[model samples]
Target: MAWIHLLIASIFEVVFALGTNATDGFTKFWPSVVTLVAAAAGVYFLSLALRTLDVSVGYTIWTGVGSVGTVTLGTIIFDEELNAGKVLAFVLIIGGVLGLKLADRKSGTTQPAEPEPAPVSV
Candidate 1:
């Protein structure tokens, strides 16, 4: 559930980023409103995820997701640069996110397995 919230929040981050760009330095009213709403939602979801996940790991992933998504969106929507180095950076960011998830899972932080009780002799 927390992971789901995080994923949604990450996507909202992208929306917020684009909304801000469209706002044109706050000169645009509707885009600014949309940007504010999306930013709020993104923070809300991030808070939800933080309730269960470690702050260090969760926050890092949150920012990474947002950054990667924003860069990709910029390239596609804004015709921003998409050089090989940028592509490589995107791959590295995604790999790091996956690594963090795996690390958390390995640490039994995501969902813990129940421990067996000690045998009791009468």
Candidate 2:
């Protein structure tokens, strides 16, 4: 469930990034509105996912996936460059995200356990 929330957040992050480009320096009202709304939603969902997932793992995956989505979509929508270097970088980012997820699953701890309370001196 937390992973699902993180995926939603990453989608929103991509939407927010692409929408920002359409905002025309925020002069375009509708695009600016969309960008702002997407940004808010992304953060909201991310916070929800963090309740169960470790921040280091969750946040890294969020940004990594979001970046790949943004670049991939940007090229198709805006006719931006998609060079081999960018493709290679995307592959690495995706590998890292997958590795983190696998590590988390194997460890059986999505988040860090709470520290034990110290004994109080009488």
Candidate 3:
């Protein structure tokens, strides 16, 4: 469930990034609205996912996936360059995200135990 939320958030992150580019510094009304909405949605979903997933793991994956999506879409939509270096970076980012997921799975989702109250004075 958390993973699903994270995935949704990541998609929104991509949309937010692409939409920001189209906004032209918020000069365009519709694009700016879309960008702001996407940004809000991405953060909201990310917060939901963070309830279960560790901040370190969840945030990293969100940004990593978002970056890859943005670049991939940017290339197609904006005609941005897609050189070997960028491709290599994407591969590395993806590999790191996968590694984090695997590690999280192995560790399992166990919240820390709450500390007990100290004994009352006599």
Q: What is candidate 3's lDDT per residue for 47-90, written digit by digit as tens?
A: 98898899989999999999999999999999999999999999
Give a tens-digit lDDT track for model 2, residues 24-110: 999999999999999999999999899889899999999999999999999999999999999999999999999999998998877
Q: After superposition, how far is residue 118 of candidate 3 from its true place, in Å?
A: 25
Poorest 10 consecutive residues by lDDT, candidate 1: 107-116
Clashes of 1: 0
User: Which candidate would rank higher by TM-score, 1 or 3?
Assistant: 3
- What ordering of candidates by TM-score runs from best to worst? 2, 3, 1
Poorest 10 consecutive residues by lDDT, candidate 2: 107-116
> Candidate 1: where is the Cα deviation over 4 Å?
110-122
- What ranges in model 3 sit over 4 Å off? 109-122
Model 1: colliding residue pairs: none
* Candidate number with greatest TM-score: 2
Runs of candidate 2 exceeding 4 Å displacement: 112-122
TM-score of each: 0.87, 0.90, 0.89
Report the error of model 2 at residue 97, Å.
Answer: 0.7
Write out the backbone clash pairs for model 2: none
